[model samples]
Target: MKTDSLVFWWRSLALLLAMGLLALVLQPFFGGTIALATMLVGVLGLLAYHLRNLHRLGRWLNDPGPETVPESYGAWEAAYGQLYRLVRSQGKSQRMLSAALDRFVAAGEAMPEGVVVLDSQDRIEWCNPKSMQHLGLDRKKDLGQHIAYLVRLPAFQQYLTAQDYSQPAILRNLAGGDSVLSVQLVPFDSTRKLLLTRDITQLERVQTVHRDFVANVSHELRTPLTVVGGFLETLLDLPDMDPASRESQLKLMFEQTGRMQRLVEDLLALSRLENGIEIREDRVDVRSLAQVLATEAGGLSKGRHTLRIELQEGAGGVRGNYDELHSAFGNLVSNAVRYTPDGGEIRLKWRVEDGCGAFSVEDSGLGIEAQHIPRLTERFYRVDRGRSRSTGGTGLGLAIVKHIAQRHQARLDISSEPGKGSCFCIRFPTNRLLEPEELVTSGQ
Candidate 1:
């Protein structure tokens, strides 16, 4: 027994002894009648007190601490031992539950997707950090508040009631930014639900762009194809045509075929450039390269446009695939020559700017509008479709140039004043441009 229990038992025994002694003293003072009455009362009182103490001791001995169990005095030892074991088992179970809950909380917090839990009344019960960040929630203020009331969006409210789990609805961010979010609601327990949110702005943009590209490409190709077909049918029907008419028809057919071929070739080149086929990096001498391209472009222009070359001395060579760099510069020069009016001057310049080589082509031609400048590199995009077709442009030249610049980690900058002229400039990174000695030491 414990010291406290022993002390209690001793005090109880002394009280009983004192009561018995008092009964004996009363018996001596008032003979049998008085003593018997006093003895009876004392015995009854003592019995009641003893019964109460016994009950209390039984309760203490059989207590399962925080847990409750039935008292068993007849088998006190066994009951007491079982009570302790039960208490320990309960404690271990509670600890295990706590640990599991902690782990669950940690996992939920770590998730990139926003997670929120709602109660039976559709009130915000709990939410992870991501959920709070995504929804711009204040836990203390928002807790126990109805989700419908807080969100206030009609679409989301309808989604909750409809229970349509097929597709998620897009929700605008409440955090005051142009952020788009896709939200999904999942039914959990009897009256609980889990809400998931994901950022899909970029994905949505890509999907929109893809849809537009397909429609645009189809329309563009179909228009030319339809024209070619009609012209071919006309030529075939005129079996006895004059030589001049036949020659004209054949020339028209040839032009259409050439246009289609150019479009196909440009498409293939752009695809290859985007598909990550590694290209050999070599020192590209912009000065000599620009001169050669100018010569070729001059011939292609048929003396209709004047080509001028300005190469800065010691302009330092750029490190890139020579063919791709050549193609990029060639496209710019060709486009300039094609767009400029007859006898118009087309300037090709190469120079070192801010520790990097900058190659620019400026043409006195119909310039692009400011709004169209941002999307000028989009494949098959043209400001003036009629002019582009007339010039035999595949509409992929600038797109190809943009891709090549990206591959070589170069920056392309375009500046144009409508009707004044346009300049297409490509600036190579400093590391990509090396001194002549460095190039020579690296075996060119």
Candidate 2:
């Protein structure tokens, strides 16, 4: 009842008392029956007015609003005003709640991680867009459906049954492919649960790579260290050994140390590149660089292979760090020299292809298989580990070249066949390339 309701009943009682007094005052002028009859009519009229007001109030309540609040007299007027205020206040609160809900839903939809709301029965209540993608859920079709039935992963089912959500469960290939998800259930409000999922595919890959890198580095260093240690022990034991045998053992030790040193240097170079070391942007003369590479390749080849240098007339230059580019180009040329058979031809070319400046090393040597080309840029990836070691390759040459290319906003392109030949090219975008006139304008 409204606070004004008491006023309404009090006012009604006061009017009834006044009517009774009027009936008593007219008792002598009329007669007892007439006066009583008059009082009864007054009472009936009051009852009819009250019933009519009640009917109006009931009708207004069916579609209650400030404009639709029924108007009345006396205390009823105050009652209608209070009821209208109450309805307006409730409407305002409902609107505020609705806006808050909208904002919360928008935030959830924009989140990167997946979020799903579940009822006490583990049935879907709502899910964000990411949850739909991560869990392969259909919002329209999957709502009110059991989450376990849709997910259908044994680990997930077991996790739900366990109900011990102290730790998250890792689900692999949940949505198929190589995808990984970290899923956890958080109980809220006694019955409802919040199902959170995060894509961990890249994280898992990075961890695997980290583990492999550590293992590979350990294995690579252990071999040479063991050989060096064994030789030292042998030499210490046999100090009176023949000079020829001693000299040979010393040379072997020197080679192993040199290999280890090279590996360390390559590792450091790769690290620097990966760590985004600032590059010194300078105009690098490609023609002169090619000649230098050719000379170095010839020395590395040691008359075992025929080396040739080709320079396109308008190939011009590129804007990049001179030493980094030199290192990149040197790696390609050296790789060709190392891998090619005796008397095989290694051609170093600097040319402008499709408006992009390109430096290519083509070798008629032991070529790589097609499948190995994709992973060639991975550190220490070798098609044949023994052959790579025998050829004095650090298995980081291509990886280094790739990083250098990326830093310079260029790309490394490799094409090879098993028997015929291989071509490795670093193509700099047109924007990075300088025409002959531009090079001259820059006083390079």
Candidate 3:
């Protein structure tokens, strides 16, 4: 090893002093052997220490280094320190990223709509809580399974193959009863896809109702107008006809005109109900209203049918527009009289049940089937079109009843069996039911 100037000068001084002492004493080997041995031992020990340090540095460079070292260790320690800090920073950043990802996943799981992630092979990689619930998925069994196999819906399978990201596809959930879903496929990364599902059962139902409403309205109007037009043409051709025949023709024309007017009025009422227009709410007495309806129905029936009243004593009154409630109840009673055969019994009942006021009309007429019961209140829906026409029904009676009941916060219950009889009941909510004192004071 090369020595510094100070070490070289000190060594030189030591050697000179040793030689001078030997010469002054005239001794042949004065201190020469001792001095040589001491110098040799000192130099060897220094070399060994330097070699060990060099070996340790080599090992550190080959493997991993310590976290800290003294500054005196020079470039080796500085380089190692920089590397350690860089690794530590990266580890902290990775932990933060992992935490953020966990939060995102948790949020998605809590959503109401379904979410699914898929790989390039169309295999399920991950799914959220809603997805499992909507699809009835068993996570342990479904993981890594082909999406088509698990879902098996034709629309969803087609969507996956089509790779069309512009629009979503609608699929019915066969596993769930009568549930519908709108599914969308989105490309995430180069090899991954995101499948989103939203429930649209209610929306679909509304759309269907809209479509049926338009068609039924058109048909109902067209039929009446056609009959009126044909009758007018016949009258024009028979201007000089016999007086008796002319009278009968005029009577028929008047009946058709009345039917048309009623149909138009019912149509207007339905429109108003659908648009949520505000109407005046007044207290209506069911007993008095039923009595009035019985009188009107009696006139319509010409006393051919028996009209019976079954009023419960002190039955609370309903809160609604008087005219609307009158029309609704009147339609039910009149329809019973018109539809029932001659001498048939039409019973009108008013009572309070379970803290709610209820009005029921029971008639011995042709009963409705179970399948038709749900849609009976739909506008212009006729179970027997020919019978409805023959009876001069506007085909909007039950629809009007349904609307009025809904507006008054009442529930309509219909019970009928084939060839037996039908009962239509309207139950008013407690809030819409009046106290007995109020009913008595109102002269109802």
Best by TM-score: 2
- Tens-digit lDDT track of model 3 for 269-384: 87787798887977777777887888899899997888899999888577788888888898888888878888788999999889888899998877789999998887778889
| Ten-residue region with minimum lDDT total, candidate 1 | 70-79
Cα lDDT for residue 186, model 1?
84
TM-score, predicted candidate 3 vs. hidden true structure: 0.74
Tell me the lDDT of model 3 at 210: 89
Residue 114's lDDT in candidate 1: 91
- Could you give candidate 2's per-residue lDDT for residues 55-79 as a string of tens digits? 9999997888878888888757777
Ranking by lDDT: 2, 1, 3
lDDT of 2: 0.91
Which ranges in model 2 have alpha carbons more than 4 Å from their true place?
1-14, 17-39, 437-444
Backbone Cα, N, C clashes tallied per candidate: 0, 0, 0
Of the two candidates 1 and 2, the one with more favorable TM-score, higher being better, is 2
- Model 1 — TM-score against the truth? 0.76
Candidate lDDT values, in order: 0.82, 0.91, 0.79
Cα deviation in Å at residue 66, candidate 1? 13
TM-score of each: 0.76, 0.93, 0.74
Residue clash pairs of candidate 1: none
Stronger candidate by lDDT (1 vs 2): 2
Q: Which lDDT tens digits does candidate 1 get at residues 1-444?
A: 364455555665776687778777887678878877776787787678667646865776565463554443322434344556767788899999999999999999999999989998889998888888777777889988888887766778788888786789888755567778888988888778888988887898889778987887677688778878987898789888899988887788788878788788888898999899998988776766877898899798998987888888777678888889888999999899888888788999988988877999999988878999998998778989889888889888999999999999998999999988899999988889877654532332
